[model samples]
Target chain A: MKNQWIHIFSGTVKVKLTGKGIERFLNQLTKNGVSIWNVRKHGSEAVTFYVNLQDVKKLRIPARDSNCKIRFLERAGGPFFLSKLWTNSGFFIGACLFLGLIMLLSNMVWGIEIRGANPATEHHIRKELDKMGISVGKMQFSIDNVESVQRELTDKIGALTWIGVELKGTTYHFQVVEKSEPKKAEVIGPRHLIAKRKAAIVKIFVEKGEPVVKVNDYVLPGQLLVSGLYGNEDDMKTVAASGEILGETWYSTKVELPLKSTFQVFNGSEKRKYSLKIAGRTLPVWGFGDPDFKEYETEVNDHPIKFFKWELPLMVEKKTLREREEVTRIYSREEAVESAKELARKDIKNHLPENAIIKGEKILHQSIENDKVKLTTHFTIIEDIAVGQPISQGD
Target chain B: MAKKWGQYVRKWMTQKMDLPQDVMMDLPRITMIGQVHIYIENHRGLLAFSDGEVRLMIKHGQLLVKGKAFVIKTILPEEILLEGKIDQVIYIND
Candidate 1:
């Protein structure tokens, strides 16, 4: 291998020779395509000159008998080092790498997020977005008519009120606002508050109109509870189109709670896992397989695909396993009775609205029915089951 | 034979005396008095002295002077002065 030459000193090259001899060397070097850099004299006896490496190679001297000495001094090459770094090949390769990185990053959408949507509205929006070529793995070039596509999607889907598309860095973010459904106006032209499901009426209160069905009446779905009629014994005139109905409905419920139940309580020590999904395929990024917890049950619900407006994209799923301890204790006769009463009250409460008033509760019977304790409860409640609004003249 | 003897005598005298040829060559010299300090590059020796005592060595360019509380008022790159009672002085060869 040829020796790699580097200049490590900066002072002038000194030659203890006559000025005529120095000029001769310069002429010879120039004839051979050598370059001279600088020349300086320290005193009368020595003259130093700097030359390029090519010129240095072409330098020759006469016989040693002549009164002249030739010595090669090192030169510092700090600026040369900087110049070499800016070479054509190095600069070209650097530019290519940078441009390649930018191109690759622009092709992949780093962020895709949807906001202001309920689950159902978001699902429809996601489907619409996918049809508009905004889904994962779809190139940006495929989307030709962006504005018209957005307009068509919003007009067809009743949920989306406004949609916006934004590109930040390499990611495309879709922001959406769902249109709220208009509420139904009250039926003012001869209507009644009807039952929505099959239930026996337990109590009734007439707040604004006459009741059609009395208490203890078994009503089916769509059966009217309050009549929208007025006038004495003669011809019944429909004064108001609809009347408000407030009645308590009853339901029979059978819930089996084992005498010795096993319930797991988490012991605070849990393991968390993370995954990344793309196009229905999930890739685990953090934890390995599903975790195994001691004395614990695992419930895994993995949803690898997510929709934004109408576009389906990849989603990350997280699962956690926690250690648990199951403990069981025996219940005395009074404890069991109280437990049964509580369970019956919960069952009756589930049948009524959140604002229902429980007027009274009476235990009809308590017995062991086929290896399970059963308690029959008779509850008097006042609740409003009227969902339709009464329409007036102006409305 | 006499010329050879004279050359040997000249070399012995130079070695014994140790006189430097270039007095203004790169020599490190520092001077300080009170709050000001000065450094003279390529210093040779003291040509003259006034207002304070001067101690210098032409060979080693080392000089130190002690006095009764002198303050360095101002400083430049080449020259320095001291203002106090001259108590001690020393010099060494380069």
Candidate 2:
């Protein structure tokens, strides 16, 4: 196999060895490790075979020793092709020039596209980018300097939020996202932390300002938990009143669940169908007749083999649907109570904030009726009750 | 006495080691594939070449193959590959 590849690359010659001493001549050739293949005899005077072009020089010794005459019949492979290439020098030079021209053209930026920008922002960015050597007609490879230029563009143009630099086949695509006006912050001079909910204080740790209330204090919604003012007249100071105040908050939740429920069960059977959709027109390619099951769920999948960037009208869509039977189950009283408790917990969780800790829970009511149960639970949660109130300097 | 020792050693190698007889005794081992191609291993040299026959020198004899369109596909110091329409293969012991 290796010998064949060598013959193919460097070219091989089919030569006819004539005269009576051909066998001795072949023996000498093989002894010297000269590779030859595909030998065939045409009458007693001549035998034809293939030899490597490199080994043709070594054939002279054996030909003379064995009194045989060697003659070339055919030349093949890359060496032969190269020899032909040298004969047409003008065509070769022209071909190289044409290829070099194409390569030269491919490196120059042909078009510049600025997207997601207004005319004013576009003009601003284009000017900045052009000054950074990213304009049209610039060499595409010089865009390596685009990173620092990208930062410069963002800094020079305050309106740009996000900027991108891309070179796509001799075209510069500059994408930009403009910045929107920021909302103004409302700052007040003094502030106090007040109870947002009516609850008994569980814990309070003030990091700044003076504490006005302690733990276990029953406070109304508008009462202050921490005062922002400090010191005694003339040297008095006011901070933002930063503190975490956890209070015991209460909530009530109700839940109802039916004793009987229906669930789906597979019947161990399935059907498949294949179809093709072209330009909004669907042609059923396979599978026939209506579905066997009355209640079944269908899943559709369409895969279109794309060409270039366009979605050709032709596409293959496969739909697989499974049939299921509904079965009803009745729950016992104990089972119903367990499920009812679970339902009541989930319902209370929905009404509580994420940071609200449920410290205690009690079932306030439970009633059973026709195929249903209703339950109500009261929950005690330790949650932050601080609310900021902006006050005037005089207050 | 030396010839006897050589024969004894060849026998021991052939029986004990199970090596190819051609390797142990320096004898030509000819293998043929459906009379289309022939491989002669452990050969001395090629004697004659013709359109209808090939003659090769083996260790103790000359191997003569009479065939039509005879060709020496490959010839080596110790082996030769022949391809032809072979009708007969005769070992003329010398």
Compute each candidate's TM-score over C-alphas. 0.35, 0.41
Question: What clash count does candidate 2 reach?
Answer: 0
> Which regions of candidate 1 deviate over 4 angstroms?
A1-187, A193-225, A231-236, A239-241, A244-251, A271-321, A324-333, A365-372, A385-395, B1-94
TM-score of 2: 0.41
Those runs of model 2 whose alpha carbons end farther than 4 Å from true positions after fitting are A1-190, A233-235, A263-270, B1-94
lDDT of 1 at B78: 28
lDDT of 1 by residue, A292-315 (tens): 665655534343232223333655
RMSD of each: 24.8, 25.9
Candidate 2 backbone collisions, by pair: none
RMSD in Å for candidate 2, one decimal? 25.9
Candidate 2 residues A200-230, lDDT tens each? Answer: 8999988877889989998889999889889
Best-performing candidate as measured by lDDT: 2
- Tell me how far the alpha carbon of residue B63 in candidate 2 is from the true structure, in angstroms, after superposition: 88
Model 1 Cα displacement at A266 (Å)? 2.2
